[model samples]
Target: MPHKRAKRSIRDAETAKKGHNLAPQASTYDDTPRSASRIFNAHAVQSAFRKAGRITSEDTGERKPKPSSSTNTSSSSSSSKLKPQNGSSSSTTPTTKQTDPKKPAIPSILPNESLGEYNRRVEEFLRPGVSKAIKEAASIKAAEEAAFRREKKDRKKRTRIERLVKLGKMPQAALDELDKEMKNKAGKRKRGDEDEGSGSDDNDDDGDKTTTKPREREEKSFKPIEAPRRLNDIVQAPPSLPHLRKLGQEKKVGKGVYGAVGKGSGKDPLNAGQRRILEEERERVVKMYRDMKAAREEAKVEEKGAKVKVKV
Candidate 1:
């Protein structure tokens, strides 16, 4: 609606007289009879048409200015543009911040950048610091883990030493000496095991030298193992076929035989159900006999009335 008041056209016009370049300035103000109305100027139209025709015919937008008359006119017009006295918004050109043209260490975000582009920029800028922090954290965690493992190993060694001391297998002073042994490069190295081994060898040599009597020679008691003479004689003899024994041969009965165990008529025929009934009847008969014995015991106790006569 606001732009409706403004009208621009390059339709009909004749450049009969000396013409100038047409450049219309847009006006913005509170609405008024003159400000809201559209105006048509014949001279302005003619100027715009001549300018367009000149541009198309010349074919080059970057036209070189004629020096003599236009030089002074352009200088005066450009210099006449007043700088903003206060905070005026009437200037056509936007103010640009002054910055160095050389690229910076970290690339800056663009005005119309997409999300993925922004993420990439952030990663490029912060990559060094983030990676360094992660490496430092990992190193610290590894150091802590290594220290924990070392502490556990030391605790196990101490427990073994303590147990040996309590059991009297190792002396208390030995345990103390072991604990006090220098572990660092600046101190003495331990050779206690080598010393103990040498000492035990020396004691064994001394015992051997101080023996009461020379080790007695015992009579030989071992007998050599020998195969039977008959086995040797038989092996040395010529090979011959072994005699067959009738009793050792397996017997094969005809059809309907009870495997190799019987002729299939040695035992009585019985089914699974009949065997189960017989077992049940056996259990019932045993229970009945036990009941009768208990009743006889009760009757004898009643008749005797807790008194029994012992014959002299």
Candidate 2:
């Protein structure tokens, strides 16, 4: 009986201790609130509030109620101020002006204005010199023409004189007279010769007979003699005295005879000094010849002496 009582007391003490631990735990849990919303789905709750009109969507087109008339008046006043600033800048900065399309940009200068002025200035600068040169040239040409004409006249006169001299047709005095007469009669003689045809009948008959003669006889009769032969023959003949006088102002030899000497000689001619030198040289040559002859004779004598000695 004592053992059963001890066991029942132990079981009762264990049941009380268990009740004490459960009561505190049940009170702490019961005292805390059940949160009612999730922490992670906060955006979904906020979107639901927005759709319900509790939150406003400013950027999106979920139309909010329109603003009052006072707000619109303030915005219009700001825009009008900005428009005046742009208009003032456009008015102050000017546009570039257009140029004329038809006209060329470079200007033209006239030839008559520039070139004419240059030509006039050049002419003024050179006029005096050019005129002086022209005058000098004219004077020189006139002098040349006058000289040419004088030379021609002198040559003609000389030829006429020489022809007359060769023909033995004129003395000095007669030559001057004949020249004047010929000058006067020249036109008349030319006309007469043209009209004469063959010449007078008697002259023609004589000419025919002359032509029929041997050509050699005709040539011999008319041909000029060589100067040397003429001088030698004429110098010896006495008939040349009158002819020598007609040579006038010419140096004469042996009274009215022209001695041929120097340039005038028919054979060898000499000036006074040349003639003297020649005579001296000739004398020296003759002396040399005599000396040579004497030397040859001496040599011949020496040879004969050598031959006699050899014989001995």
Candidate 3:
């Protein structure tokens, strides 16, 4: 319990006995009534955390223990205090009313044993397994909750991806590209592991040689996509100079070119849709170019009219 409420409180005097009430509160007459603290529902708090037992007033230290002696307190000067004094030197025989023993309200529901004795016996019986069960239950619940959170997080990510796809922010090609990149990375990692195990320095030296090669350098290299300066540089440049020929591709052997060969076409070799997709993409580019040209012409005409108006 928190130190604040552990001390005897006003509720102890007020609720201790049926015939009792708290002694007349002693305070400065100038004291205005303080706003009462908001009362919270204990059960609600308990349920929020999925606690097994209901929270009682005792749990919050709000309710003090009921007096063990089930008798009325005598009117005395010490009684004016908030709590009854403990370990008093003067002991008096507490007065009791002569009455017949009351029958048990629960009938056969309660065990035919005293509370202290029965509790001790039952605890001795179940003590061996109860603690282990409680710990296991807590661990299992934590694991389940952790799994549920992971599942929820993944579901949220999937939903976000789906929304992006619907909004056209994420293309299907982007997903495929990511999958291909992941596969490539996995393959590269596996190859690296194999290289480490086999003690292969030859491939490493070859990579270093390739990087050092002057022809592969970019500064003086030509790009195939770039328009030729003289329009016929494609055939004018010597085949021996790879940079001047086609930027990169050089058919030194086989049916495939060198640049395309290194890249593995990276595309699906068995794909039948590549031709269809390329045709559709070409058509889309042409249409887009026409629309852009029309827009530029329209904007130029508008600008000319605005300038003519300003001159006038």
Candidate 4:
């Protein structure tokens, strides 16, 4: 609705008012307007073209210094400094030195490197330490396995000693000695014996010999285990009760006087149910005797196997 110049003046007034509230300018601030240069230079477009390699012509979109007779000597000296000593026409750009062709290409971190390059170098440096740590862990695992085996063997030995002591075959002193040895070695046995006991064994031989004499006496003093007495082979005869025998005999006859009321002054005769219960009880006693006999046979076999003949 407003005229162009009136609108422009109004906008300018508003901007000037807003500018007063702005933060302080940066140190790189430039007062000159860039409107003309932005259109004519077109730096963004030139950079894009350069990156795409589309700027094929000699025109680099940059202004080159003009050659003048007054600066000829300075330009010649600068150009001379840029040239190689070999006097080749090629530009003296730096090239990385070639390495051995046969060697594998190893990634390395150079000055100002980042990302994959830095990571590669760090990994290479840590490789040996990582491998060594893995090997050490494996060795520790092996040591643990060996220690577990030794502990299992020691447990079996302890159990055997305990059994012998319970059976009166071994004295309590041997068990106490084993316990003492276990306590002494508890802390130092994890990494396995390192030949420290070899010298101690030689030095303590006399003491060991003296101790062995008492152990031998204890072994000799132990009484032999006497075999348990065999059960009495005499079979006792059944009771001579007339009423029970009569009832049992009557049971053999089918439809006999089993459930009928008895006509006697003495205790009433056992009924069919009572006779049946008595028969079951008798059978149970016979089964128990058979089981006992089998158990005795098994014990005899075990005792034969357990007998050890000392070659004196």
Candidate 5:
């Protein structure tokens, strides 16, 4: 049992040592050999750094570094080794670098031959179809403009016709004739008057005498017609109503009525019989109005002028 226990203790110590060597350790400020080894190993543990380099190479494929002859040789060898399994290879050859011209030449104001050729090509590409479209559009626009002008002219003509119609003038068909006649008559009359004024003495005297004879004849033929007198003028005075006077009263009469002293006399406007008849007539008028109202209510009649239709 002692021997077995001693062996087991030796095995545990060896296992612990291996674990200590393999496990990651926290870093601290120390330069001990063990710590130094730990730091070195930590840096060295980036074994996949080659993958990052390859990824960079893949991303920037075939880009040549500055080609010193020495570098060229080394890169050629390295590139050959790193050649892709897909049979693709990166170039190690140096590219010829173009130096920018010392002064950039000023562009010509006029197009160069190449620019002219390019322009011609573009124009040739668009010419047939674009020109046809443009012409068709212009033609349509012209037609529309012409139609608009025609419509405008027609509208003006219609307005002129309407104006003439309203003024009770000749219709459009006769307007030109009427205008021409009026112009001709005005011209003729003006010329005739001018001739009459500027004619030789004998002709002017004859013209004046002829015009004066017509004036004399017109005055001689004129006769005034008598106008009938108005009824108001003929009467001259307003008619008077019958006088009413009260008993024992003397009253001066006016145009309308007299005092109550004349009442019931033969000369009174209303004698006793006439006064009774007037009272009966007043009652009849009142009864008639009442009967008319009752008849309207019985017939369920509304007032005649109440309802009216309104236009919206």
Candidate 6:
């Protein structure tokens, strides 16, 4: 409760004459205490923490006590405040509710039991459950972490494969094999789910008819798949150097080959399709050069024939 100051009273109320001048000054402020400071017990502290979810009841080994005589008095005062005259309920006595038999009653603190003994008893009552919960939580977290790492690795590998494919490094056969593996895995998962469903149904029926024996479960073997060889490995290409020129610098033509344009690492080879396209482009360039040479020779021959005609 907050401390409230006493209200000031009129200084000369009794001696005041009609129309007499009243004292302009009021009384000084009073500093008297209103309510005593609250005292906290360990049990009350534990109960507060429990209610606030900061600690479990088993951790403190204390149970909340039922409302005492003080609460009853407070209830009576509240009932008086909400009287029938104030349009409240007319019942004078509070009703007693029946306890459910299915619900377990809280273990009461023994009169002779110390706090330490109560804590020990609580620990004894809760140890098994707490340990089991801890183990399950730890195992679940470990499995989740392992799964996350595996997924991260797989994602990195997939991205690497995609990057190589874009750079014309991976072979067509490798891509085909990867697609086939994915399809087979999907099919296997669907079949496995169906099999498990049927097996569970059969087990349930057999259990109903007779006692079922515990079956030893076989561990599934996990084999790591080997990554396919890069196309460059099959068709060796000349080692290309990286571009060493800085930005904004003019590229010198007819000087030296700077680097291969749009090509990734020199070690990574081009796919068969790219190689074929390069071969076709080379053949076309050669054919165009030969035609130009033949045309230049014919022009020279026509100039000579005109010179001979003029001489005759």
**Stretches of model 2 off by over 4 angstroms after superposition:** 1-113, 171-312
Candidate 1 vs candidate 4: the lDDT winner is 4
Candidate 1, overall lDDT? 0.64
User: Which residue runs does candidate 6 get wrong by more than 4 Å?
Assistant: 1-106, 176-312
lDDT of 3 by residue, 123-160 (tens): 77557678988997998799689767865775676677
List, residue by residue over 32-124, the lDDT tens digit for candidate 1: 565334344556866887888643324432322223344577675754543323333432233332256552344555668887997797788
Residue pairs in clash, model 6:
232-269
lDDT (Cα) of model 4: 0.70
User: Which 10-residue window of candidate 2 scores lowest in summed lDDT?
Assistant: 102-111
Report the number of the highest-TM-score candidate. 6
Question: Which predicted model would earn the best lDDT?
Answer: 4
Error of 4 at 237 (Å): 99
lDDT at 25 for candidate 4? 67
Model 4: residues >4 Å from true position, as ranges? 1-117, 187-312
- lDDT, candidates in the order shown: 0.64, 0.64, 0.62, 0.70, 0.64, 0.67
TM-score of each: 0.25, 0.20, 0.20, 0.26, 0.21, 0.29
Ranked by TM-score, the better of candidates 1 and 2 is 1
Error of 5 at 9 (Å): 71
Cα lDDT for residue 53, candidate 3: 56
How far in Å is the alpha carbon of 72 misplaced in model 3? 60
Candidate 5 backbone collisions, by pair: 244-259, 245-259, 245-260, 245-261, 245-262, 246-260, 246-261, 246-262, 247-261
Better candidate number, 3 or 6, judged by TM-score: 6
